[model samples]
Target: MEWLARVMGARRAIEVGTFTGYSALCLARGLGPQGRLLCLDINEDWTHVARTYWRKAGVADRIALRLGPAATTLATLPQEPGFDLGFIDADKENGRLYYEEVLARLRPGGVLILDNVLWGGKVVERRQHPGDTSLQAICELNDFAAADERVQPAFLPLGDGLLLLRKR
Candidate 1:
């Protein structure tokens, strides 16, 4: 993630699910000295630990933490394409919605990455477990993104799965 940000010369980025702020740290370090990262998460406990680590890493000044529902927070931002990079690792049920919101805000030629896309390989299972909303959402997103013309999609099997979309 850090390499991607730096290679793309990202100055403004946003992360939708900042669990412990590790990803945020990587992004903050990748960004230029004057760059900024917006972190949105609903859990204060996790974010507190993230904050401590960010401070320790000396990147706290470059990141802004917003505590609330990620979707709601995203909706409040202006409709312009303001982000050079985006990472989404939040609630599974709202995965597609988050993707849409983030992709809409991604600048031309920007990158948007969605984590846990394979959902432990359940996305391609022959028979899915009943009520497995996460699996369903991931499969739907994979198909939607691949068919969408606004971005070029690449699925990497790193970790569970990393879906990368470069906006056209």
Candidate 2:
């Protein structure tokens, strides 16, 4: 993720799920000196630890952590394209919603990465359970990205699958 941001020369980024700040740290390090990162997550306890790590890494000044439902936080931002990079690793049930919201805010040529698209291989199961909304949502997201013309997508089979979508 850090490599992607650095390669893209991202100056503005947003992360939908920041668990203990590991990914955020990588992203902040990749961003330019004047770059800014907005982190949205609900757990204060975990984010507290993330803050400590960010401070230790000397990137705390560039990151703003928002504690709340990610959807609400995202909705508060302007709808126009602004963000240069985005990472989504939050609730699976709302995968499509987050994708739409984030993609709408991503500038052309920006990258939006969605993690855990494979759901531990459940996505490829022979017979999917009807009640697994997370799996259903992920499958829907994969199909949507494949057919969506707004972006070019590369679905990597890396750990649990990472879908990298570059906006056109």
Candidate 3:
């Protein structure tokens, strides 16, 4: 994430699922002093952990935590045309919607990172449990992203497959 943030020269970033704020902090470190990060998550307990770490990392001032449905929070923000970077690691069923929202707000050269896209190899299975909506959504999202000409997409096999989408 540090490398990703640096590569993009990210000034403002949005993280869809901030589990303990590790990734958020990682990205925050790469941001310039003036840069800010908006972290959206429904878990206040997890966000509490993130808050502690952010303060310890001395980046608390640069990070804001929004506790609610990520989609709703994202929709409420003023349409800026684009953000510097966006990381999606939330509910799989909302992958497409999240992608659309984030992409609509991504700068021309900004990046959108989607985690667990490989679904721990479950995506290759011909048969899957009906309850595995997250995996199913991921599969659909992967196909959609691959065919999207607006962004350059690459699926990397790193920690359960990370889909890197760069807005064109």
Candidate 4:
């Protein structure tokens, strides 16, 4: 992620899911001194840990954590191009909404990563279960990205699957 940010010359970024801030820390390390990151998560308890680690790593000044529904927070953002990169690792059912919101906010050539897209490999199963709504949502997101021409997309098998997009 650091290499990707450096290569893209990304300065502003948003992370939708900040469980413990490990990913944020990784991305922060690749940013320049003036770079800033906005992290959004609904849980204060989880982000409390993230804050601690960010402070320990001396990157707290560069990251801001917003506690609220991700979709609501994202909707409140100005609908203009600004962010250089976006990471979506939030609720599986809302993945597509997050994708659409982030893609519209991203500048040209921005990278968007949607994590846990495979749902433990249930996306490929022929039989569906009762609690497979999340799986269905992920599959829908995958299909949506694969068919969308506005961005270049790749579905990787890495780390529970990653739907990587480079906005065109």
Among all candidates shown, the one with the greatest lDDT: 2
TM-score of 4: 0.95
lDDT of 2: 0.93
Greater TM-score among 2 and 3 belongs to 2
lDDT of 4 at 16: 98
lDDT of each: 0.92, 0.93, 0.89, 0.88
Instruction: Determine which window of 10 residues in candidate 2 has minimal summed lDDT.
Output: 125-134
Q: How do the residues 14-79 of candidate 3 rate in per-residue lDDT, one tens digit apiece?
A: 999998999999989987677799999999999999999999999999998999999999899877
Per-residue lDDT for 131 in model 3? 71
Q: Cα deviation in Å at residue 32, candidate 4? A: 2.5
- TM accuracy, model 1: 0.97
TM-score, candidate 2, is: 0.96
Off by over 4 Å in 1: none
TM-score sort, best first: 1, 2, 3, 4
The true-versus-predicted C-alpha distance at residue 40 of model 2, in Å, is: 0.7
> lDDT of candidate 4 vs native?
0.88
Compute the lDDT of residue 149 as modeled in candidate 4.
Answer: 94
> Please, what are the lDDT tens digits per residue for candidate 1 over residues 1-168?
989999999999999999999999999999968889999999999999999999999999999999999999999999999999999999888988899899999999999999998888787781556588777777788889989999999989999999899999
Q: Can you write out model 2's per-residue Cα lDDT over 24-96, one digit (the tens) per residue?
A: 9999999967999999999999999999999999999999999999999889999998899999999988888
Could you estimate the TM-score for every candidate? 0.97, 0.96, 0.95, 0.95
